[model samples]
Target chain A: MRKLSKVITIFVMVFLSVALSFAQGSGDKLGDQSKLIKTLNKPLTFVFIPKVIHPWYDVVKEGALAAAEEFKKMGITVNIKFDAPTNADISEQMKKIEANISARPDGLAIAALDPATNTRLINDAIKAKLNVITFDTDAPNSNRPLYVGHSKDFQDGYDLGEYLAKLINYKGKVGILSGSLTAPNHVGRVKGFKEAIAKYPGISIVFDRPDNDDLQKAVELTENALQANSDLVGIFGCNASNPIGAARAVKAAGKTGKVHIVGMDDLPETLQLIKEGVIDATKAQRQWEIGYWAVKYLVAMNQNHTIPAVHETGSRLITKNDL
Target chain B: MKKFIKTKEMSMFIALAILCLIMTVSTSTFMTPYNIGIIARQISFIAIVAIGQTIVLLTGGIDLSVGSIAGLSGILCSLLMTKMHVDTLSIIFISLVLGIILGCVNGILIGRLKLNAFIVTLAMGEIYGGLILVITRGYPILDLPESFAFLGQGMIGLVPVPVIFMLVITVVIAYILENTPFGRNIYAVGGNSVAAKLAGIKVENVTLYVYMLSGMFASFSGLLLTSRMNAGQPTIGSSWVMPSVTAAIIGGTSLSGGEGTIIGTIIGAAFMGVLANGIVLLNISSYWERVITGAVVIIAVVIDLLRKIRSQKE
Candidate 1:
């Protein structure tokens, strides 16, 4: 009985330590640097809320922090607070925004999960006199001053579609695996892809499915797609997870080079897969630029400096040769 | 033969057969060996997890932590291989042992402490799920060894390696449930815990062992998926918890306990696999796929319930 208690105690301690470590948000202090010019004396705090807690947003946070470091060199104290919901939930995100608003930060930048609902919240934040901006995902109808992120999701998808069509010589069946069916970005990409491929007389889309942003679901759906269309020659992944998932299925089916794959985002797994030749190319979004510019623009807004209504941090297509 | 035909497993098997028949007729590719192999491998992961869930359900307990354990185990195994440079065999052994230990924790909390199984496992599930995100930080562990891929992608005489593992697990577990005293004790405890204790059964020990087995099975499935994907994905098993329970329930496992079979769970999983595969093969719209799948599950359970009513009356 005593030994059992000891084992239980150890387990509980380990769990508590791990949980406590992860409780804090991904915010780090900037190093000290001699001031080039004493422009601002007071420390400014800004909060960035993304759709969910994902590695993609983590990269964005890195950019926001990098901007903070730049301001430190200018003798400006910029404190960045990064917070996001654990799951991609609208209500949870709304609650975070509300809480941050009440906290009265100098600025708030959000990646809208639902444009309709977030537009209302963004308006409310503006009414509260807080400088507001948007990033990654934009709520155009909102009162926010500027949007800093990639705005050409459809064009990027079209480019990928054209590339895949050419790779397959414009005469083979293709499939598309996207993230959520409702996400505007994913939907736009899918729409653009179908339009681009429709120009090819012989190329036809045989299967289209949503993996709901799950890697395993993406794998299963791709496997099923491959089985359903035995002669499928190309696949388009409309998000970060799906392309890697699709590549895994293609490799397992022993059709690595036989089937061409193009996808969105430059997740580490997706890049490795591209290097391995299992995947042909991916659309690399400028996540760091979006973060850096979001903070920069938010500071300008606070200082009453005019900023552009849209700051497009564009994306580029990455192939094996690019890597 | 009449008695066998009247069984719940028989009803489920019929449903599965009907699904397969519809797919085979609707799509020319559905019945081919290639498609069959894909379906078999797809179902094997869920089928393995459902086996352990079936045991826990037989004890009138639910194991919500199965999915989280699977995800964490896969991540840990990948980390060990990539960061620690551990050998594949030792890593597999270490992961299985870790799974057992994790399950044992749940068992002790619920079995020894006499806590509510639902609440205990649910909390444990959240803890394990959070641990995965913390460890991986929402990134997949990539660059697994090429040799490890055999566990997920290899074929032996037209059968997937994971499928073989699933079959072996099913047979061993089936034998234990039917032919062992411990297995019988599990049913008794679920049927009536006080009565089981009065009959000199160590109910706590049975509960502990069942949860341990559940953890081990979930971990094994996680390992197989990691090998198959050739990367340790943090989101590997997030979508599995609901399916694990659904598969057991569809296979005719009673929610109240002590009235399910291993064969029923396998057929249940296969039914779901065929349903998903058929939707794709028949070119069903993506928007309507979930609605159709949900409707099919309801119809299957209703048919099983009606069959049970008829058998009871007769």
Candidate 2:
């Protein structure tokens, strides 16, 4: 048994090292082309790191690839390397950023999962002579220049809040289903929603539930809010899965079409709910544009150190009509 | 009845009853039929998974990969149903077989090959979980057939279908544990493997079967959850591992092995479900839920240790 376990451990170590070396080799291959323009003599390589591997990030990858294609058309030979942890983890993101930096890419783009832990890493990468840009999530305290990302999450939430209020005729009790309270983006959205709802004196935020980004918890929170508040006319979800969960809750409560729901993000389930009229609307982040512009900005920064410090990629509000 | 009250399982039941009473008194919504139905349905998933964990625990082993098996089976079942146009029942049958196969891998590795159960299942979990992401690409499979939802979302009169499923499983497992020779051998193997081997029991086979059952139960839960959500979500089973283990431990299943009851695990899962419901009903901050849950689990473990020491003295 001991010998078998030893063999297994050895096999796993060999597999991991092989995978790691492949990751490094692929990153280096992008810059190996010898023939290029005088100004862009060496093939420029940039690594785009997201918080995790999700459908949202897949769309972002598409945008980055599109930008890479455009750069290639311009004879600049821009190689955009994309990688993320299999799951959403801050430490994993940190490790990936460190690995990317060691690969000696011309530039690096990352969506920081936590500003405090990642800011120092971003600064270290800058010190290592890697031009760093952040998209989707920004670390303003870091020395990295240029943030090509979304509009204020607060505005996204405020718009959903105001839109939900109008959908319910501006006079009803509403509940806010949010993700983790400590998450900065979720908090900002909730703040904006609260501020927006305060304008209409008739609209009151009666219930505040944080689901920790679990679909089950989100559903339970929404259901409990409904059971507690019999007169709840609307629910505003400040995270991607919240609206889908709220829609399920509303349907289970037999309050479909009666209870209004607006959530953030364009998850497939959320879109299906909107088409079914279970959800009134959803705030769709411009993930593609965020990715496209981040790569473009990184390339421009590598070519000439003259790029804007901040760029805002706006969001869209999707309704049943859009479906 | 007096003897029942003195047993650890009864204490767990009392804990559940006390928690429910507190919730009912604190919030009018807690006693409502809607809230009760939702809680019952929610408890069903964890309860089913915990049964598998309890059996594995009883056999002096752990299966951390149950959650990943759940996720893999759900995604695979959904894909078979929607993409290949297979009927729902067949898809479920296929998932059960797949679960057994996946569990057999762990069984062979740990039971036959004598690898450490903890490390073997943990490695298997990562592999299965990784497969889930690769299959779905982090997107949910949203094209489930309408008929499939009946397993999870349907109601038999006032009780939800999932709750019914939970009850049926509990009864079957309870009967097997109390009435079957195979079940008795499982306890024997867990109690002392060398002694059981000396007594002509096939310890390796018992270990393999328990893990296979665990895998089967976990996959059953995966299918139910996928049906309830009306999609095959890659995130379906990530949060289940701890809760299932917690349910087993809280129900008086000793981690060292050879002692547990299905009834006790049912109450343990119910206790957890009620606690979460109470937190929501009382308008308590959700941020405190995890902290409270961890503290309560620790308290349960301490109490279990105390009971063991007292029983030893007796």
Each candidate: what lDDT? 0.85, 0.83
For model 1, state the Cα shift of residue B303 in Å.
2.6
Residue B248 lDDT, candidate 1, scale 0-100: 87
lDDT of 2 by residue, A118-217 (tens): 6767886888788888888898888878888884899999899889888888898999887865467888899899999999999888898778677899
lDDT per residue (tens digit) for residues A37-151 in model 1: 2345589988888887678887898999999999889877888877775557554465456556655678899998767557767987899788889999998988888999997
- C-alpha positional error of residue B70 in candidate 1 after TM-score superposition, expressed in Å: 0.3
Q: Model 2 off-target regions past 4 Å?
A: A1-323
Model 1 residue-pair collision total: 0
Superposition error at B176 for model 2 (Å): 0.7
Residue by residue across B1-314, what tens digits does model 1's lDDT show? 99778788898898789878887777676787766876788789889999999999999999999989999999999998999898878877987898899899999998999999999999999999889978975556877888887887789999999999999999999999989998899889888989999999999999999999999999989898778766787766666777788888888888888888999999989988777666545544334545776776687679778877887898
Name the top lDDT candidate. Answer: 1
Instruction: List, for all models, the DockQ compared with the true complex.
Output: 0.02, 0.02
Off-target runs (Cα >4 Å) in candidate 1 are A1-323
Task: For residues B1-314, write the lDDT of model 2, one tens digit per residue.
Answer: 88878888998888888898887777665776666777788789889999988999998999999989999999899898888988878877887898889888989898999999999999999999989977875556766888988897789999999899899999999899889999898888888889999999999999899889999998989999888766676766767888899998888888888888888889889988788767544544344667888888898889988987998999
